[model samples]
Every structure is written in structure tokens, then in C-alpha cells.
Target: MSNILRIATFNVHKGLSTFNARFSLHDQRELLRKLHADIVFLQEVQDEHAKHSKRFSPFPLNGQLEFLADAVWPNYSYGKNSVYPAGHHGNAVLSKFPIINTENRDISAHSVEQRGMLHCEISIPGWDQTLHCICVHLGLFARWRTKQLQEVKRFIEDHVPADSPLIIAGDFNDWSLNAGRSFAESLHLREVFEHSHGKPAQSFPSWLPILRLDRIYTRGFSIRHVEVHTGPTWLKVSDHAVLTATLAHQTA
Candidate 1:
């Protein structure tokens, strides 16, 4: 059995291209399949959008999480953060392993921006300990994001074990790099890109990524490789490019 795990995170922009001109969930699904990630953390996933279904003939009858998961990732969980008359959207996690439990926590600092953390406890076939995965989407403002980070810390302290394997991935919206330091100091977790290459990966504006907006942080795992997928296809798929990391459990 392989001990190494492949993980990825992406903000799908609600299955639409920049400015909502291109509605192409199929393209996003195809690109995700090519990544072959064992675990995927998604932000801006549409749980239900009645209007979109009517507008786009190809929109899956099921939610975007189910459509993207397909057959590869059978176990998945979605957290609804923002709700409207049309529908709701939020964070989602798709895992190849069994998801034993899940919870969606509303972490929004204010009413203006709805955000959430989709926490999932997963059991690998042969692993002795369960893994905790949190798919996060923080606020746009620094102060609000700081508050949300504290909430995240509190959530972990209250629910997750200290020594358990933990993975947190998604769009942080912290372009100033403040969140990284906070997480490192509080949770003792290492960001995958920083651990691998000494700095966070820039993943915003997929076409010409210049902002470090997405990230993956882990505890009890050693980073082997980290990549920020870009180029034409990735650019067209979503406004934010995909972030991937290869990691293995630390030897005892």
C-alpha cells in the first residue's frame, strides 16, 4: 500500500469563468480527473443553484460536488455557507477514503461575506489513526480573517485531537501572509508550498498568477512536492489556479 498521499485545492469560482461568461463545470471536472488527487478541497462549490440549472443545459442535476467527484472520490461532504433564493454555495471535500464524520461551521465574521470550514474526519483503509481535513474559505478583510482564524483554532482545539494528522486547504484571501504565521504559531502546522520551496505558491488569476491566495497546511505530514497548476487550461477552468501537494506521514 502507498503511504504517500496526493492532495489538491482549488477555488472553482462557482463553476464559472471570470465575469461569469463561461459556464463550464464539465471542463473543470475533466481537469480535476487529470490531477488524480486522493483528496480534494474545493471552495465556491455550488450545492444547489436552481437558476443555473435552468440557464445552463449541461448543469448536472446533482450538486457540483457530486459532479466533480464522479466515481473516483466516492466519499464527499459539502458545507453550505452562502444561501440565497436561487441556492447555496460553499466549501467541499472529496476523498477516496471513507469519511467517518463531517461538520460545516459558519466562520463568517460579518453578514456581508459568508464563509465556512468544511471539516471531515476520514479513515484510510489501513491507517491506524483518523485524519482530520478542513476545507476553509476565509473572509476578504484582514481583521475579519484574523477573527475567522481564531475561530478555526478554537474549532480544532474543541474537536480535533492535538496529535492527529490534520490537513487544511483552500482560499485564504490573505495576500499579506499574516494567516500563515498565525497558523504556524498556533497550530504548529506547515504550509506545503513553504515547506517544500521556502515560500507560498502564487495561485490567483489563473492566467497570470501573481497573488498567493490559496494554500495547503498540514501537521504530522512531511511535504514531498508542491505545485501550483497554471497555463491555458487551468486559467480557463477557474479564476484561481489549483494547488497540489504530495505528502507522507512522518515516521515515528
Candidate 2:
């Protein structure tokens, strides 16, 4: 039997519409369910927001991660990256499989931009080895992103087993498009859209996407299909388009 997995990466903009025009967490949760992803990598998810809780009518009392993962994805992990008086926000991974282990690493290049990588080891049914998943949100500046990428590489090299099935996905903020080359050369990971379309999918400014800021990179899988979800409905959900990929596990 072949094991095919469908995964998605999205930057949810802290569950708010563009320009903070409105609170869209409810709509975002519905959209996530529609994706039907087996694993989801999310960035800019609000773990808590004291002010928003009072302002937004249907704000989740628990947190964005729990609200989004409600019932659909039974297993989830979050990495709190940025914290302020208002509350905290970060990256998260939601999976259908059992998540056995989770770790959050701070890779902030400066005090202003608090960034992190959320790593999870998931146990897929009938699989002999655990799958490694990393959810990341890089810094805005190119220099900071470069440093963060190195940190991610080091983290993987030190922790993940050499032969494990691995996936790293989220908002890279890499407008210059150099991160793909770095990942390919350093980690032998292939960006799904780049492998299929010869370039990364343009996923920024969801209304009319023209910049490749989001990505899904993987190892030990054969890319079957990849898509960028962008339309009027999606635009109302977030500023970045959702990137989804289908892969067939390559058995040893």
C-alpha cells in the first residue's frame, strides 16, 4: 500500500483580514477545514490576545491553534514567538496523526522580531519511523531571514535522524527567492512548487499575489501535486495564499 499525504502551509495573519479590517478567525477556521490537509503548518497564529478577545465578537476563548484545530486535527503543537502586553502569537502544526514529541526553538535575530521554529515528531499509523515536521515563520529583513535559515538547518542536523521523512513549511518571507537554493544545497530538500512548476508559487498579498513568500519543502517523498489557494474568499481570510502539496512516501 502506498502512503500519500496531503499537507498545507499558511500564514493566517493572526486571524485578521487585511489592514485589520475585520476579525476573520471564524472564516479562517472554515477555510482550513475545506483544505482537508493531513498536516497543516501555520504561522502568525495568535495563542492569546487580551484586547482582541474583548473586541472581536466570536474570538476564541482558548486560542487560535485550538480553535483552528478543533475536532478536525486532533493533534497540535504551538511555538510562541512574539509576546507583548496585548498577548502572544507564533507558529503551529496541526496533524491527523499522533504527535509524540514537540519542541520550540527561538531563532530571533533581534529583539524586535521574535521568531521561532516549531518541531514535531508525528507517529503515522503503520509507519515504522516517525515523521519530522517543522513549522517556521522567518523575519522580515533579508539578513535576519538568512541567519534564521542557518539556525533551522543546524536544528535539523542536530536533532532529526538522517534517514527520517522530514518536512519544513511556513512563511519564509523570502522575496529574493534565495532560500530554495540554500535548502536544496544544504539539506537536499525540494520545494514542492519549485519542483513541479520550476519556481516557487507567488503567495503574498493574497488578493493579487505577486511575491513568493510562503513555501513547503520536503525530503523522502515524491511530489505528486501542488497548489496555491488564492481567491476572493481566501483573500478575506489572510494576506498570504495557502500552499498545499500531495506527496507519496518513498519507502526504503
Candidate 3:
């Protein structure tokens, strides 16, 4: 029985939706397989739409989430949020372990922006417990994001068990920094990336990495190892870099 839990979070930019290239899910499967995480939280995943598929090529005929999951994580769940003429896009959780419960919560307090948090309760072998994993993607504006964060807090309080190991991660879009820390403290959750390292990783704008937006956070887990996957392989995958971590439950 393996007690070590490997988790990773990434904003896949709708499978690298580059208007110019329009390759369509190109390299996403390959890239994710390389990460080899036990559980994965993905932001900006598309379901299916031939129009959009044609517009993007490497993966045109398959549901974006299914395609990626089939190749990488076989057992997974996706929560659709923003539905537009382009297609429906949202968050997804892929797990190698048994998923006992799952829900997709709408955290978009602002009607103007579409956002979501995909929560999944997974039963890992050897952990002797279930873990609450929430995959989040917040709004663009600070005010809207703040309200959304509060909503997220309420959601967690109402749904997730307090005693269960809690992991909330994804593209927070909080380049400013303070907001994330404030929210984490309020929820009694620890930001694993920041605790292990010095700060949240610079993940957005994968080309330049100006903003420290993407993060992997765990509230009840003791941080073991934290890694930000950068360099050439990541640059071709998405607009945001991936955050990976190895964690242990806080000991008594």
C-alpha cells in the first residue's frame, strides 16, 4: 500500500487553444502522461464540438476531457461551467484511486465571468481515509474574485468534511498575492506550494511567466515536495505551467 500521494494541477488553456496553430489537443495527452500524477486537476477543459475541434486538429473528434483522460487518467469527472457558441469549457479531476463522491460547484458570483470549482472525494489505498480535492478557477477581477473566494469558503464548509484531508488547487488568477493567503487562512488551509517553497509559482503566460497565478494548495496535508514544471515541454503544452506535489497527512 502506497501512502504517498502525488497530485498535480494545471490550466490546460483549452488544450492549448492557439488560434494560429489550432492543432486541437495536441501534445496535451503526452504531456500529462509524463507528469504521472496519482491525481490531476485540470482547468479549461473542453467537452466536444466539431466546430471548435476543426478550429483547433490534433484532437478533433473526441471530447477534450475524455480524450485526455482516456490517454492519461482513465477514471475522471468533469464539471462544465461556461457554455458559449465556441463550446463548453470547465474544470475536471482525474484520479487513479476510487472516487467516492464528486460535485461541480458554480463559484461565479459575477454574471459577467464564468468560473467553477470541481470537488471530488477520493479514497486512496493506505491513507486510511478519503481526501477532498477541489479544482478551482477564479475570475479575472479582484473584487469579483474576492466574492467568489467567499463563496468557495461557504461551499467547502457546507460540503467537504472538516476532518478529511483537503486540497484546493488550480489557476487562482491572483497575481497580486495577498488575496490567496487571506482566503487560505480563513479556511484553515495551508497553501502547500508556498509553504514548501517561498511563494506561489509563476504559472500564467507560460511564455513569459510574469504573474504568479497558478497554485497547488493543501490544508490538512504536510508538504513534502513541491515542483513547478517549466522549460520547453511545458511551454508547448499550455499558457499556464503545471504545479506538482508530494504530500503526507499531518501526523498526530
Candidate 4:
């Protein structure tokens, strides 16, 4: 039997439905639990929001990331990229294994966009090597995104070991499809859907996904299966569909 790892990536839209019409953090938590992913990459995670805590009926006092991680994911790390009066939001990584180390690198292209990449070194049980995970939320502008992509590549090269397993997942906002080519050439990482289905999965506008905004890129793992969670039930949670993949550890 192959050693399998299931992972998921999602832009939770700060735990709200499309247009901020509803507070769906509770619903989002339930949906994530169903995935049963060993590691989850999340973008636009609301680390803190005083207003929402007051307005929403069951807002988690600790924070959105902690609330979602709950008991399922005992080890988690959050990187706050954007800050405001109400609170702040950013990217997060939830892991079933122990997180030995973590860092939040600021990759914001300019003052207007507060972007970041969260890197976590996970200690998988009985494994000889640590698994490197990066949770990212890039800028919207094409130029800014290009710059941020390069930064991510550089970060990986400087920090992550060349032979270690790596997974970078999140919302790239790269509708132009440039990120896929760049990462393939630079980091030698393959997007899960692209490797399995010939192209990245469409994950934006959950109700009728037409844009490929979310992605899960991997190295040193063989993808066994990939899925894009859509339809009515998923749409009620966030604007971007949840992307999940099952991978087999490549033993040398």
C-alpha cells in the first residue's frame, strides 16, 4: 500500500458567503472537516475581527483560523498580511502533523496590497524528511502577481531543501495563467489539477466557476486524485471552490 496524503486549498472569503451576505464560518468549518485533509491551505482567513465577533451569532472568540482548525487540526499557523481597524486577515495552514517551524514572509508588491506567504515545516510521523508547506495569497494586479510569484520561487529556493517534499497552495488570482508556466519552469512544481487533468481547475465564483483562481502545487509527491468542490452547498460557503488532492509519497 502507498503512503497517502490528502490536502486541500481554499480562499474562504473571510468565512462569508458571496457579497458578504451571510456569516458562514460555522458552515465553512463543517465543510472543511468533511474533507479530512491532512493539511489545509487557506487564504483570506480572518485572524481577528471585532465587528464580526459582535455581529455574528456564533463567531469564535479565539479567531477564524483557530475556530476552523478546532480539534481536527491541532497544529496550525497564521500569517496576517492585511490589517484594518476592525482587525486583520491573511493566510493560514492547518496540519494534522506537528509543525516544527513556521514563518510569514511579506510579499506585498506595494502599499495598497498587503500580501504574504506562510511557510511551515511539518514533522510527519516516522518520516525521515520534513514536509514544507506554503500558504499564499497573491496580489490581484498582473504585474504585482508576477513579482510576488518570483518572490515565492526565491523563498523556496533559499529556504526549502531541494530534495524535501513541498506543497504550495492558495489563491493566486492569476486568471491569465502565467503563474502555472512560471512555477513549472522555476520551481519544478506541478499544479495538482494540471498534472492530473491537463489544466488547473476552475474555482472562482463558486456557483458557476469560470476562473482558475485557486491552485495546489506539489513536488516530490505523485498525485492520485484531485477534486474541485462546487454546486449549491459549496457555493453557500465562499466565492472560490475548495480544491482537494490525494497524493502518494515518493520514496526514493
User: How close is every model to the real structure, measured as TM-score?
Assistant: 0.97, 0.98, 0.93, 0.98
lDDT tens string, model 2, 61-179? 89889999999999999999999999999999999999999999999999989999999999998777889999999999989999999999999999999899999999998989886
- Per-residue lDDT of candidate 1, residues 1-252 (tens digit): 577899999999999986677896888888888999999999999869999998987888888989999898999999999999999999999999999999999999999999999999999876778899999999999999999999999999999998889999999998999876787779899998987887789898888889898989999998888888897666557899999999998745
Quantify all predictions' global Cα lDDT against the true fold.
0.90, 0.91, 0.80, 0.91
lDDT tens readout by residue for model 4, 1-252: 336899999899998998898998888899999999999999999989998989988888889998999999999999999999999999999999999999999999999999999999999976778999999999899999999998999899999999999999999998889866787678888899998898899998898899998889999999999999998666578898999999988978
Count backbone overlaps in model 3.
3
Question: For model 2, what is the alpha-carbon lDDT of residue 214?
Answer: 92
lDDT of 4: 0.91
Off by over 4 Å in 1: none
Better of 3 and 4 by TM-score: 4
